[model samples]
Target: MRLMALFAAFSLSVSAQSVTRAGLTVTYRDPADRGQLARVFTVWQKAAQDLKAKGLTLPPATLTASRNASDFASLTGYPAHIAAITLKGNIYTQRLAALHARNLLPYTLRHEAFNLAQPPDLPRWLAEGLARVFSGEAQKDPPERTGLETLSERELDTLLARASGLGLNRVYREATRRAAQRLKQQGWQETLTLTSR
Candidate 1:
């Protein structure tokens, strides 16, 4: 059943973007409701400002709502895809917060903002890790374990078996220690560079 469901999703038809903003020189998908254009711009504009404060900005963003599975596949190449998929109600990432939600908007914008500030050609893990760092959720007492849980069950078991020798506190400390190192070495701009790739 799960396999069938995955296949169905993969074969779904995707719609392409039809409207392009000539004045701003940006691209957005053809919205079903034409009136939504203003709201779209408003949302994006506000998101841009929030991101700028976090040291990230999108020079111009291309927002699209694709129905095709291939369209989603193609988006793996873009940094904004972090927030882009979430713009659609159905495709939120398990590891990240929703982009449209009021509380999460700032973090989502900051993640994309870093993409805008850095050079492209970065590795996915590096970019995702850094984005999660500035995501604010990371700084709390218990960080979001989504990224860490991304490993397959088997992979996780392997890691856990190796880590079982250590106490829970020791393991957590090590994880944070490594995360801190990443923050110090790459910083924001460097991490963005890694993610944009």
Candidate 2:
């Protein structure tokens, strides 16, 4: 069954500049970005439902649209290459404009949403792979022909955590490949259930 039936309901808050509903809150720093923020909120409703249709329960999260690149990096402590991250019920991202410009708004939200909804104890390799797969981002990866499939889960986890640059991408690719294979053979809910232990 889709997780929409399972996602927990959350309380909401209302204000002049921020609005919360159905486990999500959209906020912006500048008045001028109101339109974009509203659009994000609207899109998020469906995004949540879509993920629900899979097996992830979208939690109550505050999505704060950072004003600029440096602000996003500062607030999230992530590189500019990172689109968004969900931490402690807060979703931080690049400016709505930047995301929209890069055509990354929806997938980025879905990717982070997958991360947010996953069980915290799941192995990093599996979790990252599943996040990319669930968000449909895995489909964007180039084909992998060598050097990663043989690694143990611990080794894969280490590479994913410590490797930077192209090495990181390779780890991501391998992880995604493994995750997709698992999903294809079993399914997301069961995959999550079995691998989490």
Candidate 3:
């Protein structure tokens, strides 16, 4: 059964239409969704620029848009695929509506892009936090309050509450907020060095 499923996903991926932009290639089932493709490319380009400004490099990546969340889950082995995911050189996402519903396509893509840019050994807090910061989700909070070391246990408790019910969004938000704070205080290079440890 697993082999059959893998084969099916492989076939689908192979058969999908592909478009390349800014060192990233995106594949999807519908040729008509070129608008989404354009948006994705724009987002990636902006993300690459942002990372570069921060003295980081974005590795080449391939993105695949699945027909639905179920297909995305099947392909990625995630119970709920959410907005997007990156595995090594590849990124997988659902169609545009789903991504737009959560306003997460850009954020998710950038998150995975960060993973590709940096070494894989980063702690989850740092990784998710940096992604969220880069993706513009952590702009509201002051940098001084965001360090993981500085965050109180009560704050963490509040952020982690109802995790299963609300999904990992809160956790990600906290991490991102903390990361943003780090970026502001230490700059990207130092933050990257600290997190890579």
Candidate 4:
């Protein structure tokens, strides 16, 4: 009986409910934005579907512009956020920025969903890197030539000088090798944890 109780507790600790709201979940709070609710609803549904394709599920949530109502919302893009969190039979979340650019929302949803699934294990950098990679938005090449040239002229001149001696092909090859290693070791969970932070 004691073992069964412990097992139940352990299972409950890992799985939790998640809600995501974006767009006008907040605007509705103010009478003025009520008219925009339809637009917000349309966008929110599409965003949710996009996220679903990545294996992250969102429960029914209010889409709002006001940060207070959301568990998370983007300050820059669609001002959608979510607030309530029910974790392991308890609530866990406060307010946070959750929305992202239309193109990036799917990745962000997957990233956050992984954190919810694991709860307090994964690091942030790896999570974000994973999201970026999964979304096909990962940086495929080294920093742009413009940035490199600017750096050579303004700062890190010695480093740039050394780089100039190295063959471009060698640099590319080394980068590819490192990327593969990182992917093999981190996988999706580590990547999500890396970015969650």
On TM-score, the leading prediction is 2
Query: Model 3 clash tally?
Result: 3
* TM-score to true structure, per model: 0.38, 0.82, 0.74, 0.31
Give lDDT per model, in order: 0.43, 0.77, 0.72, 0.38
State candidate 3's TM-score: 0.74
For model 1, residues 36-87, the per-residue Cα lDDT tens digits are: 4454455456656655665665565444443323444465443333343333
Model 2's TM-score against the true structure: 0.82
lDDT of 2 by residue, 1-197 (tens): 45553443211111225767667877766455565765677667777787787766777888888777787889888776677888776888877777877888878887888888887788999999988987788878877564887899889999987887777888888989988898899887788786554
Which ten residues in a row are the worst by lDDT in model 2? 7-16
Error of 3 at 55 (Å): 1.4
- Displacement of residue 173 (Cα, Å) in model 2 is 1.5
Tens digit per residue, CA lDDT, model 4, 1-197: 99999999877543332333452133222333344434445544664565566555545443223323332333332223323322342222222232332333333333333333332443333333343454343444444442332331113323322443244323323433333357688654443344322
Q: Write the per-residue lDDT of candidate 3 for residues 1-197, one digit (tens) a residue.
A: 99999999888655778888799988887544556777788888988888888788898888888877788889898656467777767888777656766777776677777777875666667776787777776664444532345666345545554354344655666677766667789888888878333
Clashing pairs in 1: 13-67, 13-68, 14-67, 14-68, 15-67, 56-113, 57-113, 121-197, 122-194, 122-197
Tell how far residue 17 is off in model 4, in angstroms.
Answer: 25
